[model samples]
Target: MVSLSLGELISSHRSRRNLSLSDLAEMSGVSKSTLSSIESGETKRPSYTTWKKIADAMDIAPSTIINAFVDTTYHPKTLEIVLAEVIREGWEALVAKVAIRYLESPRIDTFRALDHIDGTARDTENKRIKRILCDSIITFTRSRGIPSYLASALYERYLIERDDFSRFEETYRRGKELLLYTEHLYTEDRIDYYYKMGVHANILGLHDESIELCRLGLREDRTDSKQKASAYISLFNSCVYFGDIHVAAIYLKEYENSQYADFRKNHFRATLLAKKGQHEEAIELFRVCLQEAKKEGRISIVVDLMASYLEAGKTDELLRLIESEDQFLPEATPQHPYRMKTLAQYYRRKALCLISLEKFDQGFHSLSESIKYFKQLGTTSEVIDGIRLFLRHHRTNNKNLSFKNMEILEDICDNII
Candidate 1:
């Protein structure tokens, strides 16, 4: 594959759109001369950021531009990393298409490449990749259209985050209808759907729903102990969320009976123990998770452990996490939405920590960036309690939080002003 000549590539798209030099410059924030220089080959090495802005403004992904620029590889060099460009930019569809194309490639990691943390982008392209995976699995079941159950679940979550109860309830009802009556689902197929449904519920703080889906999947799953163990893990996690140690213990026992005691499962088991007054055991489990996370270079897991430390008031472990070299991938790369996303998570956590320490002014800056993250995902209300509680406990002068409770946070929750 020959790289597209800068002139040919830019000219094709620009002329195709009847866009003028100034028009492209305004759209991409590149100066006209630089744009001209690049097109005329006077500028051979444009910066990734500048080139990326041009690609994004043209509504083309880096991979597509790169494909035409350089030889296309059997393995994907870049995957489309979609972030909300404007307040109204609708990426649900763009993302859907990207996954379809990515999955078509046989050499794609298929799992690791799609592993994204929520609220930020990553060079690994994980979150969008996760969404793509879920969407693709369902597409495998539903055949390439939007899955209503997922759409409804996501919309309901979106509404809940915004405190839009009236419509949220309505969407939840609608989503359930689509989910239950979903046609063309094979019994073997529904197991993973149930797992994904549980994940969606978990994201919305709906522990019961997650537990229920996990149970459903477990009940129906026959072929794989791995899936059964996963469902049990979900149930155990839900129990932990509601502080039901009795059930959590039972699930842990069952997990022990089964052969699924990997570090990943053990990590959650540790958090459960740590939070349930078994500090020594919990800390040990956390250390295990920390080691595994470090070994695998899973920053997301590291962040989770760090968050657990923060919640557990384990200052030492939390600080260690803060100093990580991969403090969320801030380097400018063609794989952007994946880049700054980790930085977003890093900052969000830092802000929460700052707020917890009563550093109100600095806390707000970090928190504000954190909020920008949720806002991008159409998420706001879900994190309000955390934000408000942080503000309540730490706000030096505002002192708006009445107690570290949901009621006050819910009342105070509003989009950024």
Candidate 2:
């Protein structure tokens, strides 16, 4: 199990084939300088694409080159470095192949490494890198003949990356088809797929469908406790979204008894309390959950908590929470899914606060800003929701709204909602 340096391995392979560096470079379609650097150990970590090309030129498996860079126990950071190099070189397909082989290594922390890479790619704020990582994972999972659950997870990730309901619907439909008819997927994969489908359904506002899918997942007698816990949470969230608090409460209790109960339980408890008009208690619980979400770097959950604050009519508290934050409405970038909807919601909440405080002009301005972001998001449902919010709040507090603002709200709702 001698761990030869990558350069030494390359040189040995080239000499065994009696090919000069230039000959290898020509065959591999890589620059001679890059190849030289790799063989001289100057490039300690060559891209997966580069290694694959060289391996192909030398008529050897790409894993041979990958193995040259690691011994029996390699740190996860080493994998991240290689993945970053592969992504930078735009060698998604090659990296997929390499990743599949790497997963077979007994010493590798497969899921942890994959999850770390996924999170890193997400936080990178580079659209190209995110796209490459998505493509690589999809290709790797699908081609490696691994469990279909991995492929389904990657598809879900891509759906989030795309951030379009239409694409999500299409992907979910396709996943359903595969889960129902494909022989390659195991029961466990099917359960995982169903659970994810249920969660995404809730995200897309298909509450009933989400509940059904989650129930279907839970019905699987072979499902492990962890999977069952996930299904229960999905069911609870879906029920909560559909305004069935009693049913949601039942699931919440079950979830609390499950092994995964922790921060998520408190988050759900806060949601239930808020729904029941217990704002003060909900706010306290939300603050705790928000702190934990921040520590976990779960931006979406933080946004959810902010929305909850607004729903609880704790505008002053929400404003105070966001006043000193710099990344509250993180600069929208092409690499990451646009946070237009989240930003729009934030502005709408601000408008509500202003209106409640009798600041009509500032409130109108905030409303207008929210509408602008909603229009940019270009989703019919979101626009309709925005319009509905404006109309509902105006109707409930017409005495406080100026005639001009009322007219504007009427026009917007008449045209959209």
RMSD in order of candidates: 15.7, 13.3
lDDT of 2 by residue, 1-417 (tens): 345776787788888989898998899999999999988878876765677788788887544555555432244555656656655665555455434444445566656556654565566555555655555555555666545445544544544544543344455555564454324446776566677777666655577988888887777745347767777777887787778999999999988888767678888888888888787787788777766754323344455666667776667677786564453455442222124455666677677777777776777778777776665544447667766766676677764667877676666555342
Q: Report the lDDT tens digits of candidate 1 across residue range 1-417.
A: 345765667888998899999999999999999999989878876654666788888887665564443223234444433222210243444455544455455676544433321122222234434344454434433443435433433432332322332233233333453354334455755666676556445544578988887777777776556766766666776787898988888887777677765656676677666666676667667667666654333444555566667666788667666666364333432122212333446567777776666666576666655555544433346356447545555454655544433353454354432
TM-scores, one per candidate: 0.47, 0.47
Q: What are the lDDT figures for the candidates, one per model?
A: 0.56, 0.64
- Supply the global lDDT for candidate 1: 0.56
The deviation in Å at residue 175 for candidate 2 is: 4.3
Residue 138 CA error for candidate 2 (Å)?
16
* Candidate of highest lDDT: 2
